[model samples]
Target: MAGHHSIDYTSITAPYKELCMKGKGLGHLKNARGLSIEPVTGMIYVVEGGNTRIQVFSPEGSHQFILHPKFAKWGRVDLWGICINDGIVYVSDYQGGRIFLYTLDGDIITVFAKGFTTNKKMIIKMQQPMGIAINQKGDIYVCEFGANCILILENDSNNHIQTFHYQSPLSIVLRKDGSFIGSKGNLIYGKKTSAIESNQMIYEGIWATLCWFGDFDSNGNIFMSDMKGHQILIYETSSGRPTLLHIIKMTFVGSPMGIAVDRNGRIICVTDSKLHFFKGNTKAISMYS
Candidate 1:
């Protein structure tokens, strides 16, 4: 919140009449990608990747429960990136390479990691993890996208450590210099967060077209999504890098991408079926009062 911060965007209001949620069954939202907000019960944990399910809402949007995380040895769940530490709820399973851990009223609390091992250390596959980041010292950051690279499930251990290889080519996560990083595969024995500095910068160019995830906001800013440039890029690492600050053009009809930010900085996103609210640039009450 210092040096270069501007976002009035005309008091930025949108569907946010106290938050909104739209279309298609039980708590709604279809084709959605990811969302996370539970900083002590502002609830709202959506991620309906085409209805594979996980809805729970309440930062005013009401309806609080709609999960569908399957078991029988893992058989259904195609979600894609969501994070809410401490109360535990880090979901990612693009076709199930795994990364689940729920309990903010959803249950299940295991399988927090999956396949990865090559570079002559072969034997482990089934990884297509798409966008999942958590760094308040929990260190998760996955985007494996079938090993095109960025996996680190440290501390909450499941094996797989330190990996940052990127042909990235597109999506899940990426953004250089300022910090917020993602994939083609190669990493295991996980657990790393303050250790990627050999001149550290290698996720150059291409921030979105379909990036689909990234929601950090306790101050490090960063609330990504550009699904074909519909827009929503607001980075700000407070001078440690990542500067852009604001751009929320939104016109969406489908293809917006998941993004969440609340601890009062509200801005819950998701599209391809609705749920777009934005009420956080306050200061508008002099209209003749």
Candidate 2:
């Protein structure tokens, strides 16, 4: 998948078709809050707000596998954000106050608990990790909800590098150019991945909408979920201002939590163990894919 310079990312003239409403894989999803898409194969990985195992689905939204993590370790699991890098799966535990890494086959890798360090050797404890994003360099940027800031950890996630103050951001989507989309309250906006003073705002949310998890397609178009408003907002940021591409509002958007876009430009929205797939105006490539 290469650059999609020809297709316009600003509007969806056609309606989105439901791809996975009455599917077989979403039966166990109780408040499915977090989701990720594998870059190479386009498999979808999802986690629930309730204590439950991770779920894997095929590109076509077929039930593939149920990964069994150490469920007994945490009395109550409140997973908020999930991400996929290469073949490794990373999940953030909101209630547990840490993050977990696992292999594709469900093998335990390592866990990130409190007591993490900073570049200056200062100990900083992560509180209520909500959204987790791994860059190409392997750096982990987490939304520390309880602390009300965005924490940037090293690629290995052993320590911290910087912390940007945010107003209770629920999710974030990082771009390859060192910029990211951040959320606060009912709005999702973009900012440069720099220090607080140097951070540049890239046109805050165009509308009054809530975002759970957001992603960028290969063409640099962004996809975000508006759970409360029951809609999905797509935008293109190349112009001077953020251009509204489309709004996908569905009646079944029962608290749409996570929004993921695959390589084929298929948008996946999750709500209460259910996954809905839809093809956009242009089925171009995604950056991760």
Candidate lDDT values, in order: 0.63, 0.76
Point out where model 2 deviates above 4 Å: 1-27, 116-123, 194-197, 282-289
Number of the top-ranking candidate, with TM-score as the measure: 2
**Candidate 1 per-residue C-alpha lDDT over 106-224 given as tens digits, one digit per residue, 9 for 90 to 100:** 78878765465644475445477777766666767677767766665574666665666565422333222235543122211111234455634522443445555556565556666
Alpha carbon lDDT of residue 181, candidate 2? 83
The residue-by-residue lDDT of candidate 2 on 118-191, one tens digit each, is: 55566667879999998878889899888888888775746677777788878988988888887877877788
Give the TM-score of each candidate. 0.35, 0.86
Candidate 1 lDDT trough over 10 residues, lowest sum: 183-192
